[model samples]
Target: MNWNSPIPLQAQTLNSLPSIMESHEPLLSLKQYSPEIEVYPAYYREGLSGAIDDCLLRHGVAQRLKKAAELLPAGIRLVLLDGYRPIAVQQALYDRQRNHLLEQGWTESEEMYAELHRFVARPTVDPAKPPRHFTGGAVDLTLTGPNGWLNMGTPFDDFSERAATRYYEQKSDLQPDEQLIRDHRRLLYHVMNQVGFTNYSDEWWHFDFGNQAWAILTGNERACYGGVVPQASN
Candidate 1:
């Protein structure tokens, strides 16, 4: 997939696939994805590790997370949901999503494109194109306190129009308590921005540190974590 094309999400579908029937196979499969829930060897704290796990963020991100944790009152800690996903894992997620749409009778070119755009950015095309996880600069996290997980306005990996900024603005019939959720969401964004991390906008739980996107936006020449994988000495 030529992901660099400037075509809009809707256009990508019209130009690429001729018919939905021809591209019936799911974009990726579940068996192909693996979650690397590795504990950072450096931050070896016992209970703290339970709340936090290493993700795609830079090597220095653990320290930054530790600093962020300090801002929280007692009993609240950052729960690292996922980090440092391999390119293969990303491909799997994309494929799984595509496959889901196909199963739902959205086997049309336009439908598939629209379905995908809801969760992923259109320009990026395939999950492995820019390989955000390979850069080790993006992390998926949430807040966890003594009461368990704090409501951050939305659920993790929620693929819905309701997950938007305006969603929090409108009072929902299902979720009647909007004020509390909105306040917590604002706090999460505030602390993350304080530490120089940028949210992905679409996902409240998603944050990026050192990457081309971060450097380009911040006007930094060098990013904190590149594509290099550190090797252990014998």
Candidate 2:
């Protein structure tokens, strides 16, 4: 099966979708389930403002991650880079991405924001249109094998064109390194997707469940989850 298709809906269109906000799931720690999967909180390690040391996800989302891990090939592990981001962290990420684009010579304009928002969502307080990470329904993750993190063409949070989930898939003549990256991406995408997660086309490491993105991609009229309240990290 080809896992290289572009996401039908764009990032900017996610907020416009209707969500009923039915889920009241509690956030759960990934640590309690550690060794089954690894938690490496990226923002926290980077010391971003309001970052949390503990990795977290909604109850159902965590369950799905566990299931996904169980299905991975032996010696391969799913590393959770981030989950359940606070509003402050989201804002920090947004600002950082914006500044980076500006440094790259992108003028401050609607086009610049459109590009920035493709990978980093603008922070929001509204429950109905929460950023994906803020909902505990989106997760940023990658795969690690016996040696270490599998090469996925680009590093996490790389906003370049190469970061697109299907970038490698669209390539015709594959070099050995490119082939390796494509296979690794395919493995991660299929495993998480098998457990009902939807990959954000712009980021190979990002996936969604129960949020507006997932609902829209899966053709559900209502999302089961909305913005989860940001809690004090343990």
Best by TM-score: 2
Off by over 4 Å in 2: 1-15, 231-234
**Which residue pairs collide, candidate 2?**
none
lDDT tens string, model 2, 127-214? Answer: 6788999888999999998899999999999878999888887879999999889888888888888899998888999999998889
Report the C-alpha lDDT of model 1 over 1-234, residue by residue, as the tens digit: 221222111111112211111111111111122222222312223332222233334445554555666665567666666655554455556676787778878876986887786665333323223445455566667777667788876777677665653356454553545666665665666666667776665667767666554554455554545443334699
Please state the error at residue 64 of candidate 2 in Å.
0.4
Task: Provide TM-scores for the models.
Answer: 0.63, 0.91
lDDT for each candidate structure:
0.52, 0.86
